[model samples]
Target: MDIDLKELNLDELKSLQKQVVKAIGDFEQRKRDEALNAAKAIASEHGYNLEDLMGDGPTKKSKSKAAPKYAHRENPALSWTGRGRKPAWVIEHLESGKSLDELLIK
Candidate 1:
């Protein structure tokens, strides 16, 4: 239902404000209950015990001591070689008159 603010008296405006506040509170409570029920249902179907469901703490980082491979690999493209300042390898190849297009894989 559409209401014109210009047509409502002071009492009607106050009553309308109260009704809107109550509706918002009721909708929020319903949303909370629905989410709780869905989570419980998922836990039951997945065979997770109550403690297992409750213990979903913060995610931990990988503890492997070895550094990842390809950490030392140079970028294939020359896009980020710094503005007008090429890396040593690129300068060497360019000084030898090698075509930039041939150096780029793409």
Candidate 2:
């Protein structure tokens, strides 16, 4: 684990620094993933998903699933959950002067 940094030239030092940064980032990711997997195993043993414990992880955000709000007229199967971004079909219909009410599932 001991590095003779004194023998390293400026360019070599810079390259080593970059490598060190990348190694640190990779190590951190591995550690986080390992810890998460361990936590998930413990949670599963207790009959709960990791998400159930963290409520969508360390961020503690929860998203309730919403019913579909928009349906493609030509293709009924094509639908949008209306949670995040609007779908292209919805945008197209809107641009073509169709109202959201027109595509309502009701």
Q: Per-residue lDDT for 1-106 in model 2, tens only?
A: 8999999999999999999999999999999999999999999999989896777755645977888988888999999877788988899889998788898888
Off by over 4 Å in 1: 49-52, 55-106
Clashing pairs in 1: none
lDDT, each prediction: 0.66, 0.89
Off by over 4 Å in 2: 57-106
Candidate 2 lDDT score at position 42 = 98
Model 2 worst lDDT window (10 residues): 52-61
Alpha-carbon TM-score of each model against the true structure: 0.47, 0.49
